[model samples]
Target: MKDISRNDLLTKIQEVEFACLDLNLYLDTHPKDQKALMDFNMLAEEACRLRKIYEMKYGPLTNFGFSLAKYPFNWINDPWPWEYQ
Candidate 1:
C-alpha cells in the first residue's frame, strides 16, 4: 500500500475506531451476532495497525509513553492532534 499522509492515516484510524465502538455497543445486546462481531474484530485490528504505523512514522500518540523520538525528543516539535492539518 502507498504511504498515506499523516492526516489521512489519522482519519482512517478514527473512522475504524468509531466503527469498532459502534459494533461493540451493538454486540453488548446481541452477543450472538456473528457478522457484527466479525466486523468489530476487523475494525479493531485495523485501528491497532494504523496506530502502530502512525507511531512508527510520526511519534507515539500518548504524551509520555511508547514514543521513540530523535535525540532531542522531537515529538514535541509536531503539532498537537487538535492542531493537525
Candidate 2:
C-alpha cells in the first residue's frame, strides 16, 4: 500500500469516525430501520477497516486493549492525537 502522509491519513480517519458516529446516532432513534441499519453497517465496516490500517501504521487510537507482543507492537511509540495534524 502507498504511504499516505500523516495529515491526510489522520483527516480520513477522523472523517470515517464521524460518519460512523452520525450513523450510530440515527440508529439510536430508529432501531428498526433496516435500510438505515444496512447503511450504518457498511459505513461502520469501512470505518473499522480504515482504523485498523491507521493503527497498524501508526498506533492505537482507541483503548480496546489490542496487543502486538509477537508482532512488534510498540504501544508506547504510537502517536497520540496531538502528534497528528
Q: For candidate 1, lDDT tens digit of each residue in 7-68?
A: 99888888888998899999999999999998899889888888888877777776665655
lDDT by candidate, in order shown: 0.81, 0.73
Q: What is the lDDT of residue 39 in candidate 1?
A: 89
Q: How many clashes (backbone atoms < 3 Å, residues ≥3 apart in a chain or on different chains) does model 2 have?
A: 0
- Name the best candidate (by lDDT): 1
- RMSD, one per candidate, in order: 2.3, 2.5
List the candidate 1 regions with Cα displacement exceeding 4 Å: 64-75
TM-score per model over all chains? 0.79, 0.75
Q: In terms of TM-score, which candidate is strongest?
A: 1
Q: Clash totals for all models, in order?
A: 0, 0
Tens digits of per-residue lDDT for model 2, 1-85: 3478767877887887798899899999999999989988888898777777777667677554652322555555635645755
Q: For model 1, what is the C-alpha lDDT against the true structure?
A: 0.81
